[model samples]
Target: MASRKAITRSQAVKYRDASKAGKAAILDLVCAVTGFNRDYARRALRQALVPRVV
Candidate 1:
């Protein structure tokens, strides 16, 4: 299957600097869209927020 993680980075744009309630809301959205559990969704969003080095 293709990567299920494709959308997390895009969503992370809103995730950065979100309030606690806002983050929870994002997590709920992400979990609903991506079929990832809360912890994995949180980790994916955090990873996506970072600037990757080549």
Candidate 2:
């Protein structure tokens, strides 16, 4: 979802700039709410997300 990506990207700044504990907290919240894959979330937050080609 583009909206999801937009939301994630906005939060990406926080995620990328966050402290260790903050990053973990954000990841936990995101995962809990969106059921996003941890690894994928990590990538997205790093601005490394690419659309799936399936």
Candidate 3:
């Protein structure tokens, strides 16, 4: 099993934002830190951009 490190909230947000702008490296960094599939990370970032309904 791969050990995961805790990413700072700022880092996660930055990574997500960078990904939305089509930066592939951010996806890889997210995957490495969170252990999520590449496609899943991509989709997640896209979904995250939508404003949440309160």
Candidate 4:
């Protein structure tokens, strides 16, 4: 299998902009695919939401 490139900043923002319902669905998908604990994933996702500039 070929490796894919990392997601761009614009793409990340697009992902972050997903609807509340859609975002929850995506978080579930990510947790299932990565075998991550849901709580841990939620924390990490929240941290990722913090703005780097501030």
Quick one: best TM-score, which candidate?
1
RMSD of each: 1.9, 4.1, 5.1, 5.2
- Candidate 2 or 4, higher TM-score? 2
Which tens-of-lDDT digit does each residue in 5-35 have in candidate 1?
Answer: 6678777878887899999999999999889
Q: How much is 13 displaced in model 1, in angstroms? A: 2.0
Model 2 segments more than 4 A misplaced: 48-54
Q: Which prediction has more favorable TM-score, 1 or 4? A: 1
Q: TM-score per candidate, in order?
A: 0.80, 0.73, 0.58, 0.53
Ranking by TM-score: 1, 2, 3, 4
Pick the winner on lDDT between candidates 2 and 3. Answer: 2
Top lDDT model: 1
lDDT of 2 by residue, 1-54 (tens): 786677687777788778999999988777766668988777777863444577
Question: Candidate 2: lDDT of 23?
Answer: 97
**How many residue-pair clashes does candidate 4 contain?**
0
Clashing pairs in 3: none
TM-score between candidate 1 and the true structure = 0.80
Q: After superposition, how far is residue 2 of candidate 3 from its true place, in Å?
A: 19
Q: Residue-wise lDDT of candidate 4 within 1-54, one digit each (tens)?
A: 011112122224544788888767766765665565668655556555567784
